[model samples]
Target: MQQIIAAAIQFNVQQGDVEANLSHVRDALARVADRGAQLAVLPELWSTGFAYRTLTELAQRTDAVVAELQELSVRHNLVIVGSQPEPAGDNRVFNTIHVIDRGRIAATYRKLHLFSLLGEDTAFKGGERWCLAETSLGKIGVIICYDLRFPELSRRLALEGADLICVPAQWPKPRQEHWRTLLRARAIENQLPVVAANACGLIGKLDFFGMSMVIDHCGEVLADAGERPGEVLATLDRQAMTAWRAQIPCFADRRPDLY
Candidate 1:
């Protein structure tokens, strides 16, 4: 059976402190590497937290962040996935996810759905495209925090041949239940594995609940980090996923015409 070990790093992000946040992520990467993880996922806006008031000043160029992550990927020999606020030309900024594989940038996905409640729509430009990166492990799709609430986006990725999905989030305390429920729902409905890396502690006035998790296609919680700062590692069996897909055949039985 083909299997891949993945880890989600849950940590408290220091708001507006890029250097400190990057240092924290570097340490988390080491921890996951020590745990024999081939893929390490970091929380959304991990490098700068939710410094919305100073987003423009804190936002880094995409190339710079990718270069740093590339070096880390090379050193650890692992794929790393994380989101950052990046300048998008025309005085605009985008919440983008970068996927680095073996010292190279594999793909990038800009967050399509912005959270209006947090004034994200006013602050950042939403992406118009979906991104799925082909990697040594499997076909991986990327999505940000708010995107998790939309089932159609996940379904589109699954329909387009995604075996696994990674979510980088900064979900707040009040909506903790929604975060957990949506993650499992995406996994079960699409019959694919999901790895969600969420931020912990406080950022500005928002308190983040770190419940980073990995769920199997059957909606089984394989690993959960709870409301703490740490890493949760789990192995995904591609053969088992294939077998389940064959048995259930939801994708094949889809009636798009009727809909």
Candidate 2:
């Protein structure tokens, strides 16, 4: 990993309106690329924002949506990461993140943790394994919205030598502090940069407060898109992160056996 400008593209996703959402994404990504962003992260369920009743039907169009993303990635010369619904057998779907690296799919990560508070466990299936996208830029560990609460998952990614953590989320209100704090905590503990994109505006009866962020290894907020539909940009410096890790020496001092 070297110095790279990363972007978190936060926007309001019209429920079940895949075309509208895709149009917005296409324009946002074009601007992000124009701003010299090598990597762009979009919110979870970006194509269709948890339209539970029609998820399976909506998932049928994922392949086409991904093809569009590939075109954008190649045209802009950027890496894109975001989650979408994947059709599973028996009328269920999997919340999967597609890591597209300049027109090629670098990795596909099925979200491991399902948010039961919203009845996600009943509606969708969780993945058995985690994902680490090894792209030309770096090794990026991908995780979805609710997965941020589980420190063990991020620690596992750190152990796998991930250079950065990419989070695509639809984090809502009444727990904005939790979203902000946990993102930084993951970066601080793992000694890796974090680029997280979250949605903004009201959807259904829920209010989504977008606080898309980019954090450094020491947990410093490099960029923040506070409660709005916009993109946050930050330069992730690998040399600085490495120097910070060496100064702190936290990863080297872990004592896992005693526990």
Best by lDDT: 2
In candidate 1, list every pair of residues with a backbone clash. Answer: none
Model 2: per-residue lDDT, tens digit, 101-217? 999999999999999989999889999898998998999999999999999999999999899999999999989999999999999989999999999999888899999999998
lDDT of 2 at 256: 93
Stretches > 4 Å off in candidate 2: none
What's the lDDT for candidate 2? 0.94
Residues 145-181 of candidate 1 have per-residue lDDT tens digits of 9999899999999999998999999999988899989
lDDT of 1 at 163: 81
- Model 2's TM-score against the true structure: 0.99
Name the lDDT value of residue 24 in candidate 1: 83
Cα deviation in Å at residue 253, candidate 2?
0.7
Name every residue pair that clashes in candidate 2.
Answer: none
